[model samples]
Target: MGKSIFISLPVTDLKVSVAFYEALGFRNNPRFTDETAACMVWSEAISFMLLTHDKWRSFTTRPIPPSTSSEVMLALSCDSREAVDAMSQAAAAHGGTVDINPVEDHGFMYTRDLADPDGHDLAAMWMDVSPMPARS
Candidate 1:
């Protein structure tokens, strides 16, 4: 079987977080969702578990980062440059902050950054490795 990745994030508002992720094309997996957390499916191999702050605390003793701080940035691969732009636009329109960093285009790859309502970072990227220039 192929490996799967599950990223768990602490969120202040479960419903709003779920909506923001849905806007970015993730679907809710109710089988693993309840009052404290929602399992958002990005693909067959990638899933996000959004947990309420209280729920998150149970998993660790570490303090949650303040809203102005970032513990990690999640990168998601897109099918094309247009898909990256579309998802970025959707994220902004759905209460997330867009362009936390400037867009980057490297001939063979393009990327844009965004921050969810609670300030978790996300990067939408597209790459065509076949056309990439040879390294020195």
Candidate 2:
């Protein structure tokens, strides 16, 4: 069986969050989506399950983090350095903050950080794995 990951996130505004993810290249799967939740596919193997605050609370009583608090930073691979930059720009235009962390560039890799409207941190990156230099 092929393995896949579904990262579940609690969102304050479902519609806006859906648009934010869509701009970053995720397509909503209406088959698994409704007013309370959305299944955003980033790849065949990677998807995000965005749930409304009430829907999230039904799953757990744990408190949701405030906009400034973060427990994780998700990373996404890009087709090229330019793709990474483009994603960052899209993020900024769609109610996200770009460069939450400083951009990084190695000879064979590039990355830029971003935060969604609800302050979820994500890093867009591209790497030439075959051309990567060995650590000395």
Residue 9 of model 1 has an lDDT of: 94
TM-score for candidate 1: 0.93
lDDT of 1 by residue, 1-136 (tens): 5999989999999999999999999999999999999999999999999999999999999998987787788999999999999999999998899999999999798999999999999999999999767999
| C-alpha lDDT of candidate 2 relative to the true structure | 0.94
lDDT of each: 0.94, 0.94
Q: Model 2, range 1-136, lDDT digits (tens) per residue?
A: 4999999999999999999999999999999999999999999999999999999999999999997887999999999999999999999999999998889999798999999989999999999989756888
Candidate 2 TM-score versus the reference:
0.94
Clash totals for all candidate models: 0, 0
Clashing pairs in 2: none
